[model samples]
Target: MAIIPRLSTPQTSPDTGPARNNRRGMMWLAADLCFNIWALSIAKSLGVDLPPIQIVLVRALVGLAVLIPFVVWRGGMVRLANPKLQILRTMLSTIAMTGNFFAVAKLPFALFTTVNFTRPLLMMALAALILGERIRAKQWIAGGIGLIGVVIAVDPGSLGATSASGIGALFASVIAGTSAVIILRRMRNEDALTQMIWQTAGLSLTSVLPAIYFWQAPGDHWPILLSIGVLSQTAQFCFMRAHYWAEAGVIAPLGYFSLILSVTVGYFVFDEVPSIGLYLGAVLIIGAALMASHKGKRG
Candidate 1:
């Protein structure tokens, strides 16, 4: 709840306006990443006992509840420019969210976060295939490097059924998330709040039935579940504000720092020691993501 102060230190004011905003942005980005990992850690705690669908259901319901006051204050929802795309995006997001919860439950936190860094590489392939965007040789090289990193990290030969499924679910979630981003690109005119509202609403609606089927009462764990909701929403808010206030070049690299936080949590909280492969693979993946991000900014 009071994680901001712990995750990030206060930034001193800079002389220039842009410099100040960038510093603010970096701080927010740190908070965003830290908050997200905090939420995931909570989910991992719950995931051992509760079904992933049920966890997803609680998170969506709580997010929607949190947004209700804002929705009312903003004078109801804004008109959507692309309702169909919104529906499609919502469907994809539900898939992504559920998959992510499942992966969090099944995989080691460090591994879960490591594979997530490949989203940029996944997005690059999606952009080429779906958006008809041109992929440069460097982008291809980066993607290949990221892929190798994934293979090494995953270590197909060593995976058990549960870990393998977790990896599979994470990959599905990343692809679905990338597709959702592509849809977001198509609906640039839609209000961000409107999108957030619709997303929470849709995820709750779609997950309700499955969550019911697999439901385990939160019982004594309600507080932890509620915190997951609050942290996720806060993280989303910080994510948006960070990009709004800071240069992409400034914040994009900071996103990778989340892996460090995840690794810390895994080692201490879950006692998951990273193997040499994980560290080696993380290097390639982070390097590839940075290269891909720089190319996108230049393009």
Candidate 2:
């Protein structure tokens, strides 16, 4: 799943003051940060020689296993209504998942993450075009800065670096951004639990064909494969809860902390460190996200 900004009113208690809201918001940000870090780690681990479809299937199956209990506890299978939208969401999610897995498997974690970070910028543009939301000048500037960061991260000078995997990741970013825009626009109309259920169920069913055709036995990698699904579901659960407690503007910028987590993990786990150019690019991207968050709050 993609991390999108959730613009919601902070939950407040009858006795508590603004201090409570601040505390809850901070907790939400922490949760969001932790979720992304775990997600990136799982993605990196699963990148080892497995086909994207196989990884995704394992992820879907695990998500379904977790989701089944929740759905049953809530109201059983009948709770899954809106079959058509669920199908569409699932198809889009599958495409995004395939692109993301392929990119992670092929590119450096830092580079892949830098490219993925472009989602916020893409979200701004798509919000205007698809949702008819007005685009502010600040939003445009942030988007431009983010684009510069992407260019720097994906340096054309690097030999054999700009492969189809990189291109696919870029496409995935766009798809993910668009999905977020839609979710943000429709947040009021749908509950978070409902959205989560649809995504999990839809992707699980839709991906069956690709998973079947490209099916590789889990082999000795069952632990890793299971981890991917379980961690992903946990992240989604945390993200959904976070949204209920805090505003998207506050939580969204924290999502960039994933870069730091990825870089650290890449270094220790893979002994791969980001170049100075990559660091500079990361700063630019992060700055843009901060600016956008500030603008979003003001508006």
Candidate 3:
């Protein structure tokens, strides 16, 4: 029922462009990717019996712990102007995170990364169908090309369909994109750190019950769990700051670099080599991201 104060937009000289900001965003994104790869590999390597929900909950707790000191030092819990919207966004985020963690355990690292980039495609669809936003023929064509990449990556006809983990990745991808939609619609004006912190809190809370129900103590991997928390919290902070410096679309394609890095990690850490389809899928996803960036944002 109440409206938050609107700040005047800053003006930038045309010559300045978004290069500097995009570069900064690139660093933040790369860091996020590294931590992400490390966490996923840790989870898989732990060889524990814990369910994905439990792993996610532990991750949330770790992120919250890392955030608490900063949230206190930087002026304590960021007040929400719209608590209801914030809560809604947090719920969607938890679901997305759950599916993602599950997928990380199920699919190969390179394949998981390939599917994740398809978020742009989902965003394009939501923009067109849900918001009734007008899309150009070029965007649609680009999206189609991206879809082709996804199919090639998953090759779902038989091999993919039967694998629960593979399906989890699909579930996670769509849910993650939906969460992006919620953020774009309602949380656009919120402080990035504040929203992230609160959403993470919500994530921890939402996951607690499920985590408890399926609880399995992360025996012998406590250090790895701690690392997951620290890495994810830092990554989220960097991710927030990155967007502050530039448009999300500008930094979106830089994600391809993460895929490349993930492939390297997959090979060395997981002993997994990318297949031809995986390489092909990466190309399509990157190309689609470039095309989509010309039009909009990442999922």
Query: Which has the greatest lDDT?
Result: 1
Report lDDT (Cα) of residue 106, candidate 3: 67
TM-score for each model: 0.91, 0.84, 0.83
Q: Residue-pair clashes per candidate, as listed?
A: 0, 1, 0
Look at candidate 3 and tell me the lDDT of residue 70.
64
- TM-score rank order: 1, 2, 3
Give the higher-TM-score candidate: 1 or 3.
1
Per-residue C-alpha lDDT of model 1 across residues 228-260, encoded as one tens digit per residue: 888898998788778767888878888989889
Clashing pairs in 3: none
Error of 1 at 163 (Å): 0.6
On lDDT, who's better, 1 or 2? Answer: 1
- Location of the lowest summed lDDT over 10 successive residues in candidate 2: 1-10
Q: lDDT by residue for model 3 over 1-299, one digit each (tens)?
A: 00112122334678974344567667767776677677677766653356777877888887777667767777888798778877777677767776766667667788888888877777777777767778888888888999898888777764653355656655665666575564557567877567767877888898899889998766776777777777666665566556656677667666678788778888898898888987987799779868865844568
* Model 3 stretches with alpha carbons more than 4 Å out: 1-24, 70-78, 158-164, 246-250, 295-299
List the candidate 1 regions with Cα displacement exceeding 4 Å.
1-20, 296-299
Worst 10 residues of 3 by lDDT: 1-10
* Candidate 3 RMSD to the real structure: 5.5
